[model samples]
Target chain A: MRGLFAARPLLLWPAGCALLVASVAVAITIGPAGISVGEVAAVTVSRLGGADSGLSAIREGIVWDLRLPRTLLAAVCGAGLALCGVVMQSLLRNPLADPFVLGVSSGASTGAVLVVVLGVGGGALSLSTGAFLGAACSFALVLGLGHLSGGTTDRVVLSGVATMQLFSALTSLVVMSSADPEQTRGVLFWLLGSLSGASWPDVWPCLLVLLLALPACLGRAPALDALVFGQDAAGSLGIHVARTRLALLGVTALMTAALVSVVGAIGFVGLVLPHAARAIVGPGHRRLLPVSALAGAIFLVWADTVARTVLDPQELPVGVVTSLIGVPAFVHILYRGRRTA
Target chain B: MSLRAEDVSWSVGGRMIVAGVSLEPAPGQTVGLLGPNGSGKSTLLRLLAGVRRTSSGVVRLDGAPLEEIGRKGAARRIAVVEQEATPQVDLTVGDVVRLGRIPHRRAWAPLSSADEAAVEAALGHTGLTDQAEQSWHTLSGGERQRAHIARALAQEPRELLLDEPTNHLDVRHQLELLDLITRLPVTTVIALHDLNLASMFCDHLVVLREGRVVAAGPPERVVTPRLVSEVYGVRAVVSPDGPGGRPYVRFLPPTGEAR
Candidate 1:
């Protein structure tokens, strides 16, 4: 399959797009409400721009309001996170680099906590607004600290670790000192990442951000390919290394911030999906970026479906489900890498 | 003169790595830089390649300052091949060679026929046409060096700079690689450790010590017993029987303990 796609790489894009659409449709049907793919399709078509189907209000509500938005949000979040992962890993030249691992998500969590627990915005700011600000601040701090410490790629990753720990501590301090038991539970579920409250309002903005970012990233594919051999090599190949790094890093941070603000920090989708996509389509970012996004969208749609329906009446954080799958896949990647090394 | 460096110097912190060095290699001439570990050969090559900025003085191509030429413009005219290029990501040999076309590509434009032709010619020149689809990790050290040269060749550069490209290869591979480098049409500046190989291949030679140029001339005048003893702290017998009357150096065994 890898060889076939590697030969005719353009075919993979259409296949990936179809798979994503199919995954979203299938995921919308597998909840507590006994909806089928037909019902999901009918509701989406009618609500989007077709004639109204003669279905009951409650059933249509379940298909349209309850499941469809949540499923679409999962797809967008997955695609966005995976795209960020591919860029970060290639830029940093480390297989382990991801937004969640770099503490961008933790930074977002801290910002959301401050707004919710202390009313930092004095009841005027929404949770996503607080989270975006927090995400930007933490990323800036990471970049500043990394710059101060020689600004090497390894140093940037180390700075990310330091920033992550600091923000996570601040988030814990705010939650423990101020929140009551009920609010604490809500915050905990969010930190672990949940799409349970996903709605249409959350889906479009994240989708729009992804739409804008994918093209911007694709335009820089040759630059990313130059970076595979490290910054010096990239510079020798005519890339303005610092400028390219700053531009790509800024894009990934912005997209990751927007997605985390909407759905909390979903782990492993960013970390693990890029590697899988690379294996299938090879590492040329022209091909890898879109394939990774599609694979991530499909993977998360299914992962969220299992998270919400596995125990019936009790939902697991989607992060937990992804981690359950991600850890083993991560180990397999390592094991395979060892053989190659 | 093709690629020229006029009194270029580089320093890190308070320490100078390359100081007050000037060089001008004529077009199509192969120049060898001979020096010990801390002799600044690599730094000088980097400065010439425009990968590193000189702390003082200037480096120029065709009498124009490299800074004014911009990175992409310079890359189109000059190519640098370091000792090794080890990427953590998986890349095929063809992918690695194709990286040479980066300077000529626009962001949204597809790869053109010119790009494909350059890549194929480079692979053919280096005898790597069959290995284009092979994984980079599967290549031997000599093959890797050839691939690096192939990558440089694909750049279609007028000047090529290399830093100790034969460091890890065996004797035969080392000779073959140097032979290949000298045969190229581009003006070449290569850093070398082995004096005999330097004497054999270089049209001119420059010897550096402690960030300063100690000797600069043809190999017959540059590679001498007294200079080798002074610079490398070794006793050597110099004979003029090597290829093309270039001085051949054979190190004599130590006569006493601790000099």
Candidate 2:
């Protein structure tokens, strides 16, 4: 699947994209409401035409309000997170890089929990705003620490670890201090990344982030390719390595923050999907970015579908399924790496 | 185009690593930068290639300061192959070589036919055309070095800078690599540890000691036994050898008295 197809990357990408489209279509047919693909398609087509599908109220609400937006949100978060993963890995020049490696998710969780505990902004504190601010704040701390540590690859990762631990401790402290059990339970759900609150509003910002960030990523693929050789080599190649790293890192962080604020932090779609995509398309970011995005969308759609139906009326957080899958996938990567070495 | 460094020095934490050093080979000549470990050969090469800004003094490319020349403009004319540049990713040989064309290609444009031709030509020059499809990790050490040279050739630059390009090659590959380098129609500065190879292939040699240029001239003139003994701090005999009568170095074992 990896080597033979790499000779024809152009041919492989279209196939992967078609698989994503087909998977999203099939995934929408899932969930406890038992909507069929035909009904899903009819409602989607009628909605696109600004007309009603004339289905029964229960099925229409299931098709439109509950399942469709959640499925689309899953696809959006998956694509954005995966793209961020690709960027972080290339910028840091480490295969272990992911969206949460710099403590963005921890910071977001802290912001969300702070909102839940303190009841800030006179009850008008949207969790996303607090989460974005928290992400920005944590990123600043990580950068400051990384800079002081000379900004080496391992030093940056170490700084991220510090930031993550500090923010996680803060988040837990807030949860423990909260007087209301209901608020603490809500914070826990968000921390574990439940897509149950997915809605039409959650879909647009993610879609907007994707629309702006994906093209930016595509345009920088060549520069990112040069960076795989390291900063000195990239500088010799006429790429302003420092500037490029900062720009791409900012773009990836912004997009990842947007997704995390919406979907809480979906882990493995960003971590594992890029490696799978790199295996298929090779390390060139031009092909890896889009293929990873497509594969991520497909992976999350199916995972979320399983999350909705596996327990039957008692929904499991999608993060749990992703981690369950991600751990084994990561082990396989390590096992393969050792065998090859 | 010619490249020159005027009293270049680099320092960090208030300690100078490369002191005031200056050398300029005649344009299109093959110049060898000869020094032992910690003598600052690699540091000087980086300064000349504009990969590092000198703490003091200037690097001139065709009489213009390196910083004023701009990175893209310098890259179009200069290609650098640093020591110990092992790619962590599993890039194919072709993929790595195609990267040399980046300085010449538009940001989003596909590789043009000229770019493809240059890459193929570089592969042919470095004897890597047959291995273009092979994954980089599968290559032998000499092949990896040659692949990097092929990448430098693909840049189609007017000047090539290589830091210890022969550290991984065996005897025959080393000879072939130096032969190919001497034949290229570009200005070349190579940092080398092998005294004999430097004397044999280099048209001119610049010897550095403690971050300073101690001697500079044609290999036969500058590579004397006394100069080698003084810079390297060991006894060595130098004699003219081969058809071209280039100086050859023969080292004597260290004497207990010296120790």
Candidate 3:
């Protein structure tokens, strides 16, 4: 199956894309109220500017107001996270490197946790704002440390790992000390990552960020290809290695932060999605980035749907389900890598 | 283009690596830099390629200081092929060569017809036309080196800088690559450990010992037995080869006596 996909990237991308659309449709239909697929389709069509006769108000609310936003948010966040993962893997030249692995997600989680647990601000300044601030600050610190250490590739990755560990410990402290039961549960769910409270308001910002950053990242594909050969070679090819690294790192952090702020920290989606994409499309970023984005969207839409309806009334955390699925997939990839070697 | 490095000195990690090295290569001339391991041959090449900032002195291309030209501008003038390059991702051969045209390309622009022509010509020149679509990891050592050369050739720079471009190649590919490099209409500076190959291919020779130039002239004038004995710590017989009077050195076997 892997070889078949690898041999036919053009064929596989559209297949993944079609599956993603189908998964989104299923996601919008499967929830607590259990609307029919026909009702879901009618509500979606009416919302998107068609006739509205077949859909009931309750079905519309379930499909359009709640599940639609949540499912779309899941797709956007997944795509962004996966795209960020592909770029990060190429930029760092380490297959193990991901946005979360570099500690960006942990940093955002710490910020969101502090906001929820401590009620840092009474109004307007909410957990999203806190998460964004945390993510931005940690990313800045990593870049600053990278520069201070002579701007070498090794230095940047080392700094990212160090900052990640520091923020993760801080996040744990915040979670352990929270007094309010609801606040603690909220904080914990945010850390583990869930799309439970996703709304239209939350979805727009992530969509906006993804749309803005995708073109810029795609423009960098060739330079990113040059970078895989090593920094010296990239420089010899006229790439400003330090400047490009800083720019790419900043863009990836912003996208990761935007996604995390909306949907919480979804682990392994960013880490493993790119590898799967590369396994299919090879390592060319132009192909890898887009395909990974689509695959991740499909993967997360289904994962989110499962999280919501697995127990009917009580939704499991999306992060737990992703972890459950991601670990085995990750192990499979490692095994394949070993066999190839 | 002509390249001139004057009083070039460099230090890395507080240890001086290149000291007072002055050299010049005329347009379309191939100059060979010869030294033992760690004698600053690679550092000097890096300095010329603008990959490193020299501690003191100037490296000028044509007449302008290399530092004055930005990376893209400098890359248009000089292309470098380093000794060893290990790519983390398995890029196809064509993708690797396409990178050489980056200095001429805008951030978002696709490859132009001219760029494609250059890449195609480079592949043809390096005899890698058949391997253009192959993954880099699947190539043999010689093929990889040829691919590296093809990348540099695709740059179409006025000057080419190479650090041990023939390090891992078998005899056949080594001769083919050196011959191809020699025929290019560009100034070339190649650091070579093999004196015999350097004598055969390079127009001028610059021999270094302990980061200082010990001799600089035509290969025949500079590659003498005394110089080889003093710099390389080996006794050698210098003989003429080919019609151009290239000097070939034959080293005497060690006598088991400590120097």
Candidate 2: share of reference interface contacts reproduced: 0.63
Q: Estimate every model's Cα lDDT from 0 to 1.
A: 0.90, 0.86, 0.85
What TM-score would each prediction reach against the true structure? 0.96, 0.95, 0.90
TM-score, predicted candidate 1 vs. hidden true structure: 0.96
Each prediction's total of clashing residue pairs, residues at least 3 apart in sequence or on different chains, is: 0, 0, 0
Quote the positional error of residue B238 for candidate 1 in Å: 2.0
Residue A224 lDDT in candidate 1: 94
Q: By DockQ, who's the top model here?
A: 1
Better of 1 and 3 by lDDT: 1
Identify the runs in model 1 with alpha carbons over 4 angstroms from their true place.
A332-338, B253-259
Per-residue accuracy of model 1 over A1-341 as CA lDDT, tens digit each: 25899889778778888888988888888878788888887887898889786779999998888788999899999999999999999999999899665568889999999988888989999888999899999999999998999999999999999999999999999998998888788878888889997888998899999999999899899899988888877878888889888988898999999999988899999999999888888888888988999999999999999999999899999999999988998788768666456
- Deviation (Å) of B218 in candidate 3: 1.5
Which candidate comes out best when scored by TM-score?
1
Q: Candidate 3 DockQ category?
A: medium
Give the per-residue lDDT of model 2 (tens digit) for B1-259. Answer: 4898899999978978789998787878999999889999998888988988999999998999989988877888889987878776778899899989889987778789999999999999988999998888888888888888888889998899999999878999899888998898899999999999998889899999888888989988898889888888889888898448988889999887853
Writing each residue's lDDT as its tens digit, candidate 1 over B88-186 gives 787888989998999989977767999999999999999999999988888999999999899889899999998899988999999999999999999
Please give the TM-score of chain B in predicted model 2: 0.96
Docking class of 2: medium
Candidate 1 B-chain TM-score: 0.97
**Span of 10 residues, lowest total lDDT, candidate 2 chain B:** B82-91
lDDT of 3 by residue, B1-259 (tens): 4789999999978888999999889899999999889899999998898888789999988789988987888888899998889787667898789888888888777689999999999999889998988878788888888888899989988899999999978888788889989998889999998998999999999998878998999999999999998889988899896347788899998777884
Give the Cα RMSD of candidate 1: 1.9
